[model samples]
Target: MGVDLRRWWFDRQRLRGDLLWGVAGIVLVLAATLGGTLALTALFPGLAPVGEVGADPSPTVAADAASGLAVNLLLGWFFGFAIAAFQEETLFRGFLQNLLQERYGRLVAIVGQAGVFALAHFGYYPVSAWPLLLVVFLVGIVTGWLVDRRGTLLPAGIAHGFVG
Candidate 1:
């Protein structure tokens, strides 16, 4: 409520910028995730796939992965923009984060938004995966920070959609 509404405006230029930034952010995150997975497997040799030690590249697996990526890319954009990203970002970052920012500042607002975002996931899902909850929380932090930096939800929304 205390934040300036003008800063959140989404004109044509801002939309283009948001799309670029969103893609950039997701690409960086993906690269980091891939690197981390590689490092983890290296550190824990036992964690490698069963019977996959020193195995040659599998064309079938590669094809399957490519197909899956194609499907996921389409679904991600649809769900992210149409449902998940737009709605969740609006509520958590647009409303809650902005409300908290006025009183508690950016750090608290971002964290608080992220905490609530994680809790929402925890409640919606039936799984007992605590690590997933942490991942959701981290996502919230990233998206919230995006909103703060851009003063709009488009970048985070686009990124969220891609991540989905």
Candidate 2:
């Protein structure tokens, strides 16, 4: 089946459920990312991430940090919350995962979508930064599960905005 735009929209009737799940998703993502990184650091003391998270500033924001910080921060916040949030959830969970689910099954869909989600971060982290990728993969798995459980992208999108 093709992507159902209706399914991708937030169900106002389930706003409470979506918000609750979104909070849970946030906690899960943080736990996965932080815990995984800590565990890896313990195992490999010398492990170093290729780039620090939130280090790369957008071109417009970077152009003039002296004054753009405030404005760019607001813009960035909106961009993350409004655009990236919905876009990513719709793509990864609403579309890709459902596609995989139809052909492979729920478990495979969650895992397969998670694989793609982690790989999508290649732009930020190189192959050498496997630890971060591992953490991201775990985050993907949890978020994918959240979407599956909730049957909506709102929760994951909210979590993504917070985590982004």
lDDT per residue, candidate 2, 68-163, as tens digits? 677877788688778887787788888899899999999999999989988887777655566677787888898899888988888888887888
Steric collisions counted per model: 0, 0
Compute the lDDT for candidate 1: 0.74
Residue pairs with backbone overlap in model 2: none
TM-score of candidate 1 against the unseen true structure: 0.68
- What RMSD value applies to candidate 1? 6.2
Predicted structure with the largest TM-score when compared to the true one? 2
Model 1 ranges with Cα > 4 A deviation:
1-9, 28-73, 124-126
TM-score for all models, in order of appearance: 0.68, 0.80
Least lDDT summed over 10 consecutive residues: which range in candidate 1?
124-133
TM-score, cand. 2: 0.80
The per-model lDDT (C-alpha) reads: 0.74, 0.82
- In candidate 1, how many Å is residue 136 off? 0.7
